[model samples]
Target: MSHDDLERAGFKDRTRVAEALETVLGAVSGHDRTDRVALGRADGRTLAETVTAPSPVPGYDRAAMDGYAVQAADTFGASDRSPAVLRESDDGAVTPDAAVRVHTGSDLPDGADAVVMIEETETVGDEIEVFDAVAEGENVGDVGEDVAEGTELYDPGHRLRPSDLGLLKSVGVDRVEVYDPPTVGVIPTGEELVQRDPAPGEVIETNGLTVSRLADRWGAVPTYRNVVDDDPNAIRAAIQRDLAKDVVVTTGGSSVGERDHTPEVVDDLGEVLVHGVALKPGHPVALGVVEGTPVIMLPGYPVACIVNAVQFLRPVLKRAGNAPVPDLPTVEAALSRKISSEPGTRTFARVRLREADDGRIAEPTRASGSGVLSSVALADGWVVVPEGREGYDAGDTVAVENWEWSA
Candidate 1:
């Protein structure tokens, strides 16, 4: 490859980010693999089937507080001045002018319609004085109070959290059917990549490690492969080797440089839905499908690689794993300085947030190059400049989104 070839391979018209994502996702189908796991191991897994409560929580009437159970009619006019005198019963049943001891979460005594709190009752030998009156059903937890027996707990595609697991267990659900996590193969391609010490042209491999961790965080099991040299046959062989994975992600060799050959090899193997996108710092990213598996080609630049991964690969994993994709968290802040952007391209400007007299301030990082990994690592979040806007002027309000946040 030569410089002339690179120029000839330049993108004529780049696809919009939304259209590119839709095209990539349209080629993928939801995964049908499922596993039955205990509630202890169900956290962070997507539900494969609808889950309904088998039995209502608190199946029987229970006490909501530590108190003395009594019939409401017996203590109708009880007060601090003229307390109602009742005899304490050792039996587990309460009758007229009788009280039974009960604790929180304990079953209500038989024949008891209400409970008088311990603070409102005074113990005198075998006799108890009730200072306050409670209505029927007061301080009592009825059946199905927490969850109804036929109520839907979760629907398919709902990701289970720690709290969700606890709720399921409370409803007598010891095991649940969850979707199996998608499997991903991360391949790093570059002739200059090395493991450790770099001698002149050699550089350490980091994209594969970073992308593999991101895949795991997004609920996919990732297999990190050794770096492959920048050769067409080698790249094609590497991609073919990982066809069994639900997704194949390649970092580097995605641009139109002289050594870039991943896009060509992928096109030869399968159809390339998108070659370039209207995204800043990562416009050379590509999306393709080979043998029913989605392949993502990310740029070699560290920041560009991360941006493209969050935008494309994250959603791909969610779709394959049958999980919902959530929007990133954002905070409104005033721009401390101007941010320049192309009219037709969307730019993500790294910004550091700070407290100001008026409100929060978004200060753009000084080192804003695509290759500066620390700019994004050290900053709070990035401010997205839409394709229609040219740039953001100083003091303009913008939304700084934490792209690394997971649902």
Candidate 2:
């Protein structure tokens, strides 16, 4: 590869981040793979089919408190001064003017329409004195109070949580049909990468490990492969081997340099929808599709690779697994210092948050380079600058997004 080749291969115009995301997401179609997992293991899995209650929760009417079951009319107009005297029923049935002993969650006796608290009634030798008036159906847990029969509990693509599992169990759903987690093949390509102790002119691989862990955190099954050299044939073979996966993510060898053979190989294998993006620290990323599998070419720099992976690969996995992608959590804070960024390019400036006398403050990290992994690793969150803005000034209010926070 000569200078002319590099110049020709270089990106003439970078696409906006929003445009690239839309293009990649448009190519992804919903997968049909599903798994019938037990309710105990269904947490964090996306629901594949709509789940409805088979039977109403608490099917039978029961007592809501430890009290005496009595007819509403028997306690009407009763007061502490002149309490309504009623005979205690030896049997569980509550006939007219007869009160039955009942505890919380106990099934309501036949012919009982109301309950009087034990404190409100005084039992004296086969006789009961009701001091409080009660209405029909008062202090009772009605049928289907917690959940109705045939009620829609969860829709397709809804992520199950621990509380959701409890509700499913309450409705007699021991097993649930959930969408299978998307599979991701994480390949790190670089001739200088080494597994063990690196010699001169060699570097240890970290992007593959980081990306694979991120994929697992995002609810995808990731297959982390060994490092591949920057050879066209090797890159093509590695990608072809992982075409069975839902998404293929490769780190390094994606730029326009001579050693960057990933972009060309991906172009030869399939069409490259996006070559570069107008985003800070990750402009050399590429998005393509090879044999209906989405391929994400991330930059070699650790920070850049993480940024591109979160922006591109995370959403792709969510789309393939039929899961909803939500916005990252953010908190409002005041910038302690000014941060500069190129116009028409989005910037993610890492910041450390701290509490101040007035409010929270977001201080930009000292090392703000693409290759400085510690800048992001030690930071609490990042402040995003949109494409339209040049930069943010000191004391400017910004939203610090906590990307590591789980939903």
Per-candidate Cα lDDT values, in order, are 0.91, 0.90
Q: List the residue pairs that clash in candidate 2.
A: none
TM-score of each: 0.93, 0.95
Mark the 10 consecutive residues where model 1 has the least summed lDDT. 1-10
RMSD to native for every prediction?
2.5, 2.1
Best by the lDDT measure: 1
Q: Tens digit of lDDT per residue, candidate 1, span 1-407? A: 33245458686578889999999999988889999999999989999999999999998888888999889998989999999999987677999989899999888889998888899999988899999989999999998998989899899999999999989999999999999999999999999999899999899988999999989989999999999999999999999999999999999999887798888888889977888899887898999999999999999998999989999999999999999998889999999999999888889999999998899999999425888888888999899999999989999999999987755
In candidate 2 the C-alpha lDDT for residue 257 amounts to 85
Q: Which candidate leads in TM-score?
A: 2
lDDT of 2 by residue, 8-55 (tens): 866657899999999999989778999899998999999999999998
* Candidate 1: residue 46 Cα off by (Å): 1.3
